[model samples]
Target: MKMRKARTPIIGKLPLRKGTIGFRLFLYTEASKRSAEVKKYAKASRIIIYFIDRSPHLVTGNNIELISLQFLHRQSFTEKIEQLSEEYDILAIVGTVQFEYNDIPYFSLIDIFNDDHLKKLNSIICKDEPYSEMIQTLENHLTMVPSVSRLVQRLRKVIVNLELQLNVNLKEDIVIGMILHMAFLVENMKLQQPGRIFPNMEEYYNSHKEEIAKVKEVLKDIEIEYDIKLTDGEIAYICQMCLENQQL
Candidate 1:
């Protein structure tokens, strides 16, 4: 799609492209002072967020880098559109009022600016109803701060695709729940949360060794890619989750 002029009260719509990321978020702001809370929502929602600059060529001056590495991410006017062109999709405006044109889910961001807003954002990001599509969304959307990255999200896509290719019969809810639990487990492990070890979990791990091993093998690349190790406990927990729900 070509770059078109953005009318007043409009965030520039991203050009439609092949393989655009699932969601793109634009934050309307005065000058360049954007709330840090917006970034949190972006990562959790796995949506790219742009701090719409007052000047066309303004650049963000902060250390929020890794999360903003993609298009619609904070950048100068010069590089922003180029990066946006490379990645993004149907532009949706989110703010304080419900001014929507066409079919975009426009909302007033001010209305949902608290924890409630984050919850709303998460729901929007995972709007796909089918289990398969939800799996894809979870893959793109799961982010637990400095712990999880695009690498982990990408791993979700690869794993889900491989499972389908292998003809693994799994329900949508199970996959969705599994992804949420697994992501939570990893995040908790990274934080060294209490009760990290499951009681008698070792026995379960031993009995399901083969299944656990397979998952570990499949996830070996994630370890390398993210430079993080899944502790035996975390692996055991995941194995228990995956094995209990299916005849793997």
Candidate 2:
């Protein structure tokens, strides 16, 4: 039998132009902010790259370079944001730090990552592009990693049960986001490493006990099936995702 070489996984590739005649998006992250935002943007940036898929018309080349400034400089940066907005004809701002620009459209870090909300961003960036199809392609590329693909399938079942118990339908994007988070989380647990620690989780869990309990029940089977356990903080984070979906 002949041996076949394994193909490398597709991560994502950046576009080829600079601040040219196309939609410009500013990804802002503060130096003093939580590392989580930085990490989130890293994931988001990769997704954006997948979205572009080397298309020339989606986003300018410089879009990948994050804008990092100090918190104290925010007051002065308002004028700067306006300048960049005019200079680049920036269509939208997506970032961790909130900007005070009243004229420009701004989407928080969370908004750009979600499927339902990403549509809003898509409309702004490129209306002709098929949003759902692009997202599906993105998911397909991400799941090329064998572990992520397996975990995503398992997490989908857990999320479906969660929706039934909560009586709330999560959008495709939210479901995908939850699955990705859970997949990585389980991977972490399998390695005997602690996942993200939700700050003041005790108080948060106490206040939202009823909601968290439902999430716990839905997740119990998955934990046993995977032969791993979820930390309280991790469960609380999952509970928060459910609550957010409910609100939507």
Candidate 3:
């Protein structure tokens, strides 16, 4: 599908690309900043949800980077749709008002919660409803600054403590992924559960013992703050994130 001109109001009308990470839904709204509706879709889709202001033009600056870190594991670019709509490949514009254009789907907030609209949304994002348990956990952390920035600092601190260097892109991308991972870990701890067991964990642990030790040490602050112990599997998962982000 072809996109309208850059000057046009509606944007990101192109068809979904093969093997793309996921849709970047521009959720235009004049409501309160960080509404529950915005959080719901964002957590469900596990992708970037750019909250639009009253005007059609997009908001820019630090908020974009902050929000992007909140849902960064997918690696969605957070450029303003007005400037790079075509390249952004936005999935749709969902908001309280519906646009007249047919370039892309416009989902009204009124009917967005309806079963039919939700099914279409799922089809577009190529993911089923997020597990109910996980959604509850995400809602709890969605508004927490510590969940995004503090977790990022913890991971970056671990990298430095280990005397490792990571490229700029990987460093940013991995921090985003790690934030999401840690959120789930917190949830699991609340339920007296553990993260998924790593296969051949003994061998893997033997190979990366030093890295694992440092990761656990850095994560102690989070554990203390949340009053929850970190399971061995959780430590392994975090170690893998650090390793993947390391510049070899």
- Backbone clash numbers for all candidates listed: 5, 0, 0
lDDT of each: 0.43, 0.57, 0.47
Q: Summarize candidate 2's per-residue lDDT along 94-141 as a digit string, tens digits.
A: 666676353345566666566655554554444323433444554554
Clashing pairs for predicted structure model 2, backbone only: none
Candidate 3 error regions (>4 Å): 1-169
User: Highest lDDT, which number?
Assistant: 2
Across 137-237, the per-residue lDDT of candidate 3 in tens digits comes to 55676543334333333333333333222211234345445656776676678667756888889999999887788667666766765567888987887
- Worst lDDT run of 10 residues, candidate 2, spans 3-12
By TM-score rank, best first, the candidates go 2, 1, 3
lDDT tens digits by residue: candidate 1, 1-248: 12233221222243333332334444332122355755554453332233223311111221111112222333453265345434443233454323322223343445334444333333333433454454455556555434243323443443443242233444446666766665655555446665357679768777877777766765665555444577777767666655456534
Best by TM-score: 2
- Following a full C-alpha superposition, what root-mean-square deviation does model 1 have from the true structure? 18.6
Question: Which 10 consecutive residues of model 1 have the lowest summed lDDT?
Answer: 56-65
List the pairs of residues colliding in candidate 3: none
Cα-based TM-score, every candidate: 0.38, 0.41, 0.37
